[model samples]
Target: MPYFDSERFASLLEKEGFSASQAKAVINALNDVVDESTVNVTDDLITKEEQQKTIERYKNDFRQLKTDIQRMEKNDVEDVKSANERLKADIDKLKKTLQDELIRSQAGVRLDLNLEKGRIRDETVEQHDRLKNTDEKIANEIQALKTQMQGIKMQILRYMIGTITGAGTLVLGYIHFSH
Candidate 1:
């Protein structure tokens, strides 16, 4: 994956009163945490797929078990009632175990997904804040430059007017004195 520009991010953070090293550390921590959490989600997805396959295989096995139990109840000899009861209890226990495993797997997936989303949200907010601050700083700098340029222009205009007025007065004086 492409890494973010930590130097730039650190500089921005520094502007908000964080020390340079502290800013860098913060950026590094954010990147590490996000990457680690995202990787965890990826792992969770793989585990979830495996769990689903396991559940499917168990479902097939449970079906076969049910068929076997039914056949034993119908055709088996003495203690048929007790055998049926035991088989039913075993099936119920297996179902409960599968259900619990499924719930746990689903919950793990959801928790991982939620953490990934939260990390993304935090990064986005931080980026937006940095961008906003940068924009404001640039705007202020531009305004200051504009003000300085305007002042220079005004001074240049005044100098030009004064020079023209002085020349005109000198010309009129020479003409009057000669005539």
Candidate 2:
């Protein structure tokens, strides 16, 4: 608040060539306006100390939030790592199971193939025996035909000699009778 004296202001105004009554009226009006005026101090304007404390409080809250977020992120990473481990274990077990089944199936197929091969070999052996017997029978028949051919040649030779001797005897008898 500013303090002023009406006497001094009016006296100064009178020295500046104003009439005393005019000076007094002007001073009185000035005083009336001052007294009627008002100055307000609202809470919108903060003190320096209050502003510094609020800034520090906000800084602390931001730091705590950052720590909380980091902790959550670390938990999420651990969860993912553990899940991956479980999945890897499952995949390994599945691979082993599939490999075992494949080995068993292969062994079964091999056993079947060996059995079939043995059966085919037995059939071939039986067929070979039948063909051998047939060949022996044909050989015996050819030998019998050779022996019969030799007997026929001997009988033809004997018949040709007897016919020659009878013709010679008939010629001798005819000559004697004619003479």
Per-model TM values vs. the true structure: 0.32, 0.47
Q: Cα miss at 45, model 2 (Å)?
A: 0.9
Q: Note the Cα lDDT for every prediction shown.
A: 0.68, 0.66
Global lDDT of model 1: 0.68
**Clash pairs (backbone) in predicted model 2:** none
lDDT, model 2, position 13:
96
**What are the per-residue Cα lDDT tens digits for candidate 1 across 13-72?**
999999988987898899999899989988757577888999999999988877775565
Candidate 2: worst-modelled 10 consecutive residues by lDDT: 35-44
Stretches off by above 4 angstroms in model 2 are: 1-42, 123-179
In lDDT terms, which candidate is top?
A: 1
TM-score of 1: 0.32
